[model samples]
Target: MAARLPALRHRDFRALWIGSACSSISLWTLLLGNAWIVYKLSDSSLWVGVSTFASMSPYLVAPLGGMVADRAERRILVRVTRLATFGVTITLTLLALANVIEVWMVVSLAFVQGIIRSVEIPSDQALLANVVPISDLGNAVALTSTTQHGSRAAGPLLAGPLLATIGVEGAYGISALFALLAFASVRRVSVSSRGGVTRLRDVGENMREGMVYIGRTPEVAAIFILVFAHCSLTMSFDAMLPGFAETRLHSPSGGFTIMTFGVGVGALVGTFVLAMTTGARRGPLLLGTALASGISPMLMAGSHHVPHAAVGAILMGSSQAMFMALSAVLLQEVVPDHIRGRVMSLYLMSAGGVMAFMNLGFGAMADRTGAPILFFLPGAAFVVITLASIATGPYLRRIYRTGTAVAVAPAA
Candidate 1:
């Protein structure tokens, strides 16, 4: 805790972390509320899948988003995005309260919100570099990851009760309030003048450069591959789980939401553990944790009851958080500042894109072979890849060290 506490000592980083956590809570709350509304309205899993695709497919614009992030003031971007998110959530809540919210309208609004998130996500990532000193980047990244997981865990748990007590509209209204607070926090952070000219062409060219950079570097390439493999197999489970809990497990609609909360709790714990460790080497531990995270979902697939599934979800959440946080720290330490946004965007694009395709495919597959197979197959695949990654950990570490040395040599 002491090691982790140092990162919070910095005023800007502290504000960023607090604001980001609040926003994360709002985001998850909105997700739960939106899913509940869609499920209740349409009574179709396919519609849920479509809505999710609408919400997430905006990762395709990530390269452009990254370019904008590098050019714009990140603090301002954060503030604007939070305000927009607040507005969107409030509008949706009103619609729900008025009993006039249509499924298609919800889906359309989700897509619009996704567009804002595409810009916001990259800017948020790039902003940490600006707000924190370079020496504290790793710590800041860790703290940020921990805060995200903490909010994720808290949001779903809070959403369940709020939705149960006050209805989905109230849950959404609460999320809007959280978003407003997040906006206020972002407004307080002063943006550093790391300004660069906004070049639209640079979006494409910079994306190409980022791709080339990753292609030329074995470590970066490996990270991208690992992310694709893990996220594609494991992350899609969230989209499919609602249907699984509803039909296969014969649990109430809220059961799936509770499962999400379990994962969030696991993730929060994992992030805290990662943050507390000092001088942590980022290779073998990360790979091992990723493998563990990937394999945990199989347990859920085989579970005969909701409690069993909840345990599996918790493990999956924790491991996923550890994998993501450690990988982020590693990337931040290695990539050059000039192209960090583009490079990280490529990673995000790969992860998000793969997860999206996986969600569609898994949803369709669950419809066919049933939910159990959907969980078993992907979970097993993750375990296999985890082992493979561990075997190659030393080689990957060497590659990362070499590439980082070369990237920093010119600056030196």
Candidate 2:
């Protein structure tokens, strides 16, 4: 943990991490609060899916968001987005407090938040890379992932009880406070331009270049595809949890939040494990970890009791965090800095957009056939996908090595 904080030795990285942690905590709180509010408002599984969709749809423009991040002043972009989030959160809180909150209003506000998030994602990612040295980049990225998972675990654990005591309006108000803190933290960081001049035409060209590069690189493309498949098939477990808690677990609405927290706990543990073993050779290990992550969701879905489900959530969270952190390190190491933003944007798009659609689909599946089936089917699919990835590990590693050698070879 002390070693992980070395990035913090740099004043700017420390400030960025503080702001990011606060923002992430608030974001998780808002997610749980909003989901619960929507569930109560419409009392339909479909509405939950629609609301989630509205919140995540901005990932559709992630490449464009990357363009903006590469072209714009990332510090200003982050500050502006944080302020926007604060304003929207305040509005939502007021509406909820006045007893005039409607599902559409929540959805609309969520859409706005998602738009801000789209821009924020790429900018934040790029800025983090800039703040750290190239050699320490992997550790920095791992630490960032760890911090995010830590907050994900802690946020809902705090929010669950708070939601019970103060209701959704109060939750929103708390979230707004955290957002403001994040804004202050961002203001403390000094921004430096890394990439050269940004041209309008370069945005499209950069995106195209990234796509082509991934296409040519089999291993990178495979990573993106695997993430997409996992997101599509297994990552929607949260959306199905409400029905699971209500019917299978025989728990109250709060169980959904608790189960989500269980996953967070698992992720926190996983992140710590990665941070501790920062120098470990992660290539083959990451492949297995990613597969395990995909399979863990099925175990949770098949769980007969809340405890069993919690166990599954823990495994899923931990494995998934390790998988993502390592994968990001791999991509960052392999790709050139010039196009890293665009490639990472595609990575986000795969994880975000594909995962959002899966959540909606799984929710509907749970509504129709039953939530248990949601677990059983996807879990089986995840296992199959994991096994397949492991089988191809040697081939992928060879491709990566060959690509690296070719890139490093001197000019003739």
Candidate 3:
């Protein structure tokens, strides 16, 4: 197994992977907890969107976070950032237990969580490369991305039962517990990645260098565009899940948990398969899954029963998760270590930052036109984009044929 999964051969990477899995649980639970709390308080899907927006908008500042990651001791940054996450979750738990948690308060706390995540993610991504040898970097990244994203389904699934049984306060408290566990796991990692000292004044130049590097690398740039569109169109729909649950599925028990679980199950399978698979067929798999990503949402939009919605959710989750993890793996392979954190920040911005605003837009539209069109239109547009790319975009087509990240940039 160690030979098969090379990244798992490293003790620190193993520990870090376990730590990140726990952190994924906490972050996802917090997101769903905040969404449910905000929805309950305001009874408005729009405000639920606001909650998502607040939590993810911090990715806009992630480049600064990336700068910090590159300059500081990355191991310490991972430990400290996750520790701060525990603190934030505990505060939410305390406030909710007091019965004083308002929608505004939830939104505000989510923003704080977002800020911590902005710093946490870049450090985490940059740190992944340090723990494993270059030979294992691809598997390390695939596994990390899978754990961070594919396992995210566990969050909403965990929250579903907790929210049903113990209330959002209990959910928040459990999330904090997991966050603390995550902190503990990562604290045991020994490596300290301290690059050259980069002062605050040099941030602009550093940022520009990262941007320039990306511009020069067309493969990375294309993946960035694809990830941005995926997040904005498909991933942003999470904020609308409450409405999607209550109105569309018509499940008597409020099918939010079940729906998310289905998505989680599919995502787990999708990402795990990609992570575990060997070379060849990856290009076809990536392209096929991306195309399916569009179709799945339309299935959800057209669903008339819980079972149908679950099937759609499963498909949606699998397709989207596969595409995200593969794209991340591609980026990791091609990027040089010097600017890895900065480039990764832009990737975060594409996913989280773009989702933040798109959530707001989707939420507003959900109230006006209901969730069907919200799902259908984006799925349709993405389908069109996919077809166009296949037809004319030779770079993307080459990626589809070779199953590798082409055009690796030179070291700075």
TM-score of each: 0.93, 0.92, 0.97
* Best by the lDDT measure: 3
Give the alpha carbon lDDT tens digit for every residue of 267-379 in model 3: 88888778786555678887998899988998889987888888988999899988988888888888887788888988998899999999998988898899889999999
TM-score of 2: 0.92
**What order do you get sorting by TM-score, best first?**
3, 1, 2
* Most accurate candidate by TM-score: 3
Q: Candidate 2 vs candidate 3: which has greater lDDT?
A: 3
**Clashing residue pairs for model 3:** none
For TM-score, candidate 1 versus 2, the one ahead is: 1
lDDT of 2 by residue, 1-412 (tens): 5565466668888888889888887787787778888877887676777778877878878888777777778888889989888998889899988999999998898889888888887778878888878777776777778877767676677778777787888778878988899999999999574443268475657677778878777667777777787777766665677777777787746667778888788888887677655443565557667678767876776777778877887888888878777777667666666666677778888888877787787777778887877776776787787676556665445533342212221111
TM-score of 3: 0.97
What is the Å distance of residue 172 in model 1 from its true position? 1.1
Worst 10 residues of 3 by lDDT: 250-259
Worst 10 residues of 2 by lDDT: 403-412
Give candidate 1's TM-score: 0.93
Q: What is the lDDT of every predicted structure here? A: 0.76, 0.75, 0.85
lDDT of 1 by residue, 289-392 (tens): 77787678777778777888889889888988888887787777777666677777777788776676677677667766777888878878888876766566
Clash number for model 3? 0
Q: Where does the lowest 10-residue lDDT sum fall in candidate 1?
A: 403-412
Q: CA lDDT of 359 in candidate 2?
A: 75
